[model samples]
Target chain A: MFSWILLSDKKVHQAVADTVHAVTDSSAHAVAEHGAHGGDENLFTQLLHHIYDSKYLEIPFYHNPDPNKHGFELMQFEKWYGIDFSITKHVFFMWLASAVLILVLSWVARKNLKNRVPKGFGNLVEVFVVFVRDEIVLPNMGKGGLKYLPYLLTNFFFILVMNLLGLIPYGASATGNVSVTAGLAIIAFIMIQLSAIRAQGFGHYLAHLTGGVHWALWPIMIPIEVLGLFTKPFALCIRLFANMTGGHIVILALIGLIFVFKSLAVAPVSVTFALGIYMLELFVAFLQAYIFTMLTSLFMGLGMQMESHGHRH
Target chain B: MKNEENNAAGMIRSVAPYLTLGIQIAAAVVLFLFVGKYADDVLGTKPWLMVAGIVVGFAGGMIHFFREVVALSNKEEHERITKN
Candidate 1:
């Protein structure tokens, strides 16, 4: 236990030193470029550079000899119109997360269970699955929500793993990307709509949007109801994206303090605070993942249960 | 220590569902505000449409919010009663 503690302590020191080195070098570059880009523009550009998606894959333990160059260069694709469809850092991380999930989950799935729990990682996976079902899915969605379990489970794990990936060295958080969260929210929106349609039938679903009000009030109610439908998913997209990215920004800023002061004394204070935030971030990661899954189910439940529970607005 | 952590987590779990309610209310106004801006641009109306959007969106959002609260509370009460 002592050796393990010592080893981990050493690892943390190394990681923190490496991070400081990386940040200082980048800030140096940013400071150099500030003359050209305008001073204020480059102030947070170094911090933003780490958060924003890029065309390079930052590999851990593989340092570039040249200070100006870093990471393996990804494929550069020509833009079609103003939008570039080229593979970026976030996309690479997302694919890596998905591949890891598929491999590990399939391995867990193939495990035989006969009146006994599987060991190690399988057990951990089972805990999350059961937690999602009982605490998240079944609570809001109920027994009828079993059909949607697979998707909810996938969503929970995907977000959890992606959030965790961001905490690691040379790791980019795909969930921090607004577009990715928006895509997930879009899927959740479609699922919510589909759940309502399945529960209430297509005719009742249309009527529900009219809010069961008199025909005279239909015009006003329809637009409001439609907007409400979209607002939920839009909020979801922003919430996840903001929370994931915001934590990273705070951590980056906290570390950036060391460089900003140009003193070793600042390092102790900044590193300690950064470590505290990093621990809090670990909690936030799980919390955000849980919140996302919980809200998705809650929204779907609101739709599915309306037939039986709702007073038709 | 573990129980304390779980309790804190439970508190968060309970509070989280309602976070969306605030967002819904805010989003309604923002969504409509943008819609109104677009409409004003297209139809040659100025700030009037945007002002209308805020009023309409607020009222509409409030109604939706109250309905959701009632529905959710009703379910909770119903579940509590049935469980007993």
Candidate 2:
């Protein structure tokens, strides 16, 4: 089923590309007829023409003009059963990250589970797992946080892998896409609400939405509380996506300076800056993954904390 | 000794919420402004509903923001007392 979808998506992409090319070609012809002859084309006109003729940069989530021409291209389905089932680059990377995580973790688990002392890669994985459980999940969620270890651990590693993978030469960061981040945030949000409901019971959970205010003030308080729910996840989504996308944009823009100047003199400076940004991006990749996971765990913990159970104002 | 270790861990965990607070406040206000605008368009009330949206959104966002700040302060105070 997946293979068939992939095949059909490829066909759809081809059709879309063909359509774009045809439209551009017609426009170019119109311009030629109305404005500039081949020899008489001005520098600006020539530049515009070049831009038009140049294949669009093959970003992961976007449509590419040529699938065979290398770089990342999404298999566009256009529309499949009233929904677009196009397999984009981000989706592919997400799947790859999941597969890689499962394989690595399962191997680590097999090795470490049987041994009193793990060595090498298993040791490394153990260190991260322990750090997350002790420092992030346990501290935030208190004594009850142990039950949430699996979810938080999985989240941290998945995000870490996805972020790190983007630093690779040809890999795109799935988390850089708003939709992917939003999806993760939604899951976190649901977990948070579930934790709250479980801890406080349904009545108390709904009561807390009044924020301990008088019953008469509920109309005003309710909207604010509800907004609070969504704003947290929305912020989470934006924070991850923006951090990832911002770093890439900076690196790309710095590199584009070389082409813009069209001079070898600028190449060294541009490359140097781009390289620096790329290195910073690697640090940021890990930082963002850590931040996202930490925040999600904290939010979950907060939800589980009874309003009256915490320190009184 | 374990409590001391947990205290340090708690300190670290506390940092994430502050990082997100500003963004949350701004998003809340902006979201409500849009919501208000949409409501005005749908209801044909023009400026009144839009004005009400801006007021309500700002008030709610600020209230939430201040509440979080207070909660954080209180938690910090409690932690300091316990540590002492």
Candidate 3:
């Protein structure tokens, strides 16, 4: 008796194979060709020559091992999503960065609280907090900007965490994934559009979409402007995605250099680029987060500004 | 003198609006090219979608930039009227 497996270079291939083998109480070898039967790599291909198929077990991260328990084994995303999204590793990094940021900031916030004077780390963070509030959010968003501060702050910190996490050796960058960044951009897009409609009535917001052109130009401009709405958020998605991915790829390639050259001597030179890129990535982590938050504020601000000014009549 | 203030403000109004748009456009193009390089590895269909995505992205950026221009002018006019 034997077990069967699917052979593909896909990431889940191993997991699927292991599952099949664990279930079947049989020993099977992967076959490249079918027997005289004109069958392909279907269900009955190679593993059917078995008696029983038992369930495969995995080492748990931490578990009580039951579905009703706090931590269970079958939460494997690879099994469920069928795509190796590396979500756990990414989440681990995200949590690490968040934990660090919170501890440090909270310590500073606690230490710096004063009746009159601010000092040290508190002073430093205040500078950024104020800068983001004044330079980033206020100018674009206007007075209503105050309302969006919590969201803007959350965006800033979350992205800052994700970006910084990518710099760590074992950490996966969550923002490097298109889905994560896309989800963020969509949130920004919806907030901007919804607020625009609320601030300006639906009629005015729709008119804004037409770019205030003669009705003739409206035909072309409206579609373009509507496209623009999606494009800004889409650009937001790609910017964070590419920046994070690019840094990681560069670092990976630099490290790969030693392997490619097959020489220990190349290690020193490769280390230089790797270190350099990593440092740049550190700055980029902060910059990208700032840029994303700043742009979101700017868009939301513009919409609100238009609504207020347009209604002043 | 007040007119000069208005001119400077108007100038700022003109330049500031374009500033963000230009940056966004440039950024989008750079990112499009960067992702396009890895399209085959990610999407499994090679240069076709990547090339198309790049073209579409560039057009989108340019169009958005133009729209911002019109919007800015409209905004400036409204601000001027409100001042009066």
Candidate 4:
């Protein structure tokens, strides 16, 4: 009786193994037939493709015969004027952010004109505007910074909107792209240099490049000073890009844990962690926007003050 | 109270730039090294120019770093003195 029972248990175990093996083989064959280039893509690569910008945008409305293949059949434009001027999802998102900014700010302005005291959405926006003007601009740029109020305010709001929008389901963060952040940083850089030139005159601005070093040290000091000018904006670009990308990557990775283990048991834990990360990302979206704007204002203030000091000396 | 508040704000402002100091130094060095390497290729000086480039880039980056630190300290000191 003991031998018979042991044989029955062995037969049951073999049946389960055979079923699992057959299912796996069929799935693998189906995936190969569908022509998904990255066959049975592991969790990490899937997560990467989700977060990172791709050449073609996936269309939800379209259905491909092979479900394994991405519905990435969107038309791609060719190069323009010797540059790869292809429009990607990130570019569309940037344009969307800009359009939203214009519409919202205009509505707020119109509302403010009719009412002395802000109400509803206008009130909330006014609070941000006042904060940027008072806390960021006034403290850093002083009274003279008022002229730059529009520029700085635009930067803050635009970045904040872009960051917040990224947190929305199916929305990509434009600022997460290095190219976009670099573009913003370059604008800030130009403004800083321009402000310095305007404050100290052309000759004085050039003279300031000497970094107060003796003439003999100009060769070394000049290159370093010039490098300093670029490094500020470069840092600005990297900081914004890294911060935005880091949060999304973390959230995606956490969600990816469920698939990596290939077990339903991991879902509860993975999803819980992902939710926590998503909340942190929401906070980071605001914090990063504030930091980027504050740093830009501070850089402007520094340049203007340095030029003024040179004049005084 | 206002003086204390100002001091706190001043501290934040001064400390902010140091966040990027390491990156700045690295970028400066890398940028110079590349330029040096390119020049060496054109001028046929090879290793010598590249070495010189590394030295110059490093020294320049350090100088800029020190200058920024000094500037921040000076600003902080000036703020303190004016407040007092």
Which is the leading candidate under TM-score? 4
Candidate 2 chain A weakest lDDT stretch, 10 residues: A48-57
Clashing pairs in 3: A3-A47, A4-A47, A23-A53, A23-A54, A24-A53, A141-A301
The better-scoring model by TM-score among 3 and 4 is 4
Calculate each model's fnat, 2 decimals: 0.30, 0.48, 0.07, 0.52
Docking quality tier of model 2: acceptable
lDDT tens per residue, model 2, A1-313: 3443244433533433344335333222223332222233343343333222122223433443564443344466668679867776677888899999999999999999899899999999999998888778876788787888898888999999999877775466788788889999999899889888887789888877777667775666677778777877788899998998788667655644433443334557987997899999989987887778888888888878765365243
Clashing pairs in 2: none
Please list the residue runs of candidate 4 whose C-alpha ends up more than 4 Å from where it truly belongs after superposition.
A1-42, A58-75, A311-313, B4-10, B17-25, B65-72
Per-residue lDDT, model 3, residue A151, is 84
Model 3 global lDDT (CA atoms, 0 to 1): 0.63
Candidate 1: list runs displaced more than 4 Å. A1-19, A22-41, A61-69, A112-115, B1-84
Instruction: Give lDDT: candidate 4, residue A311.
Output: 39
- Model 1, B1-84: lDDT tens digits are 123225644564456546667767777777778888889999888988989988877877787678768856777688678666
Q: Model-by-model lDDT, in order?
A: 0.77, 0.70, 0.63, 0.74
Scored against the true structure, residue A189 in model 4 reaches a CA lDDT of: 96
Instruction: Tell me the spans in candidate 3 whose CA falls farther than 4 Å from its real position.
Output: A1-74, A77-87, A95-116, A210-222, A308-313, B1-84
Per-residue alpha-carbon lDDT of candidate 1 for residues A44-106, written as tens digits (9 for 90 to 100): 767788888888777655666766566777778899998998999899889888999999898
List runs of model 2 lying over 4 Å from the truth.
Answer: A1-75, A307-313, B1-12, B15-39, B60-83
Task: Give the worst 10-residue stretch by lDDT in candidate 1 chain A.
Answer: A27-36
Clashes of 2: 0
